[model samples]
Target: MELTDLLAALVAADSVNPSLVPGGAGETEVAGVIDGWAREAGLESERLEETPGRPSVLVRARGTGGGRTLLLCGHIDTVNVEGMTDPHTPRIEGERLYGRGAYDMKGGVAAALIAARDASRLGLAGDVVVAAVADEEHASLGVQEALRNVSADAAVVTEPTELELAVAHKGFVWSEIEVTGRSAHGSRPHLGIDAILKMGAVLKELEQLDRSLADRTHPLLGRASVHASQIEGGVELSSYPAQCTLGLERRTLPGEAGPEIEAEIESLLERCRQADSEFQASHRTLLVREPFEIGQEQELVGLVAEAAAEVLPEPPKITGASYWADSAFIAAAGIPTVLFGPGGEGAHAVEEWVSLADTEAVARTLVALAARICA
Candidate 1:
């Protein structure tokens, strides 16, 4: 099957992450569709369900052995499509293919499959593994499960990088802070403690922290950052709110200690306690993904660079992605991984698309890279 057609089928599969959007289709159907494609292409494929109802598909074209193993990874699930009209219907406009997951990215998945298929036909000395994982839009459970079951000496994450060699990207930790207070009627000011009002201090502290983070910069990723993502509090207009919860994420640079970040939050909370003895608050970390970086001299990175140099008209851009990806997880697990893929814009936005010409270029480059690296 053609790469474009395969990507269209994938985009049409409704693999919206259920965790991110209620009643979302999840990756079951899309995994099955990929499984069918892999089988028809003469590869060994299997469905892995690390979390029930969320499935990932692994398609392998085994080699003759005694050579390095390479994993081509892409996320199968996409964010919610609420306002976009016909998000699933893939359409080509100029050089781009428009669809929800096209850029952010089922295009990468399709490119990986095509590359793997071509490599399989050539009978390389090392294996080519193509993985389409679930839950990347929320938690990385699918890739986590895949790491436990499958691994490679090196990996290439096809994550919409505009065909750049992303050797580094930021990571983030999810945290939630809860401020507690006593609820009472609006008329009884002395009897009621307003948690919503108390959260003001927390927000101010977070703003300061964000500014502080900006001062710490990385050459590839630029600066560390923090932001409040969601907040909830209050019950009724007539009563003082008893509790307020603030959910936030801090983007960490490579080598930033997790404990130190926690300490920073704790110190901010301590400041609140010092301001008011009765101030009650608690902080907890929900999840953490370490930032990833690799030297451009690494063999896998150099191989892809060489391949991209040959395939692309302009020299391949080696840079850092602004967003986090499964590359962090895979690289953290001791497998050298880098992000490389076709680029478009509007990830998680109302409109999304991928460059068809660039997608084909990536597929061709991957085929050559796999042949060389897996030699």
Candidate 2:
């Protein structure tokens, strides 16, 4: 099948992450489709299902031996298509292929598959692995599973980057702050300690911290920051709220540690306690994905950039992404990793589409990269 057609087939499959949306179709169907295609293409393939009903597919173009293995990774699951019109039905308008996940990922997945097929014909000395991962939109379970079984010298996360080579991207940490207080009738102020009011102080401290973070910036990714995601406190109008909780997400930069962020939050809470003897608050880090940055001097970076220059009309931009990706996991596993993929728009939006021209260009570039790195 043609690359565009393969992408259309992938987009047509409903692979909404169940973790993001309740009862959503997981990566099973999409994984099956990819596995079937891999088998038909005569590529070695395997299905990874660490979590039931949420499977990932790994397709490999085997090499003769004695060279570094290169992994091309793309996620299979997509965000919900709540507001899209005929989202599962792929359509083409000029150079654009329109459908849910068309731009965000399926385009990249297709590019990797076709690139592996084409690159294998070169009979390179190294293997090319295509990882169609699952739940990247949520927890990145698929990539985590892939890493447990697959080892590679280097990896390219085929996330949509407009063909730019992304060497750095922000990571994130989720945390929750809970404040405790005494509940009493709303009519009696003296008898009640207002947890909500106490939470106000914590919010102020967080805001100040966020502002201070703006002063500390990364050259490629810019400043680290924090924002409140969800909050809940009051119960009923007639009662004083006994507890308040704030959920926040902190965007982290390279070299920032999750433990350090937790400590910082604890210090802020301590400050609140110092201000008011009754400021009883505690915080816990819920989740953390460390930031990813590969040095420009890495051989993989040079090879990918060279391939892009040859395949693209203009030299590709070397930059960073503002969003977190599965690249963090790949990098954490000790594999030098970077992000490169097709150009498009409307990722997780109502009108999602991938640039067909750019998709093909990305495939060509990946083929060229395999030749260089896997030689």
lDDT of 1 by residue, 117-149 (tens): 999887789999988899998988889888988
How displaced is residue 298 in candidate 1, in Å? 1.8
The 10-residue segment with the lowest total lDDT in model 1: 255-264
- CA RMSD for every model? 1.7, 0.8
User: Residue 169 in candidate 2 has what lDDT?
Assistant: 98
Model 1 earns a TM-score of: 0.95
Highest TM-score scorer: 2
lDDT of each: 0.91, 0.93
What's the lDDT for candidate 2? 0.93
lDDT of 2 by residue, 1-375 (tens): 879889999999999999999999999888989999999998999999989999999999999999889999999999999988899999999999999999989999999999999988999999999999999998898999999989999899989999999999998999999999889999998999889999999999999999999998999999999999999998899888899999999999999989999998999899999999988988889999999999999999999999999998877899999889999999999999999998899998999999999999999999999999899
Off by over 4 Å in 1: none
- In model 2, the worst 10-residue window by lDDT is 313-322
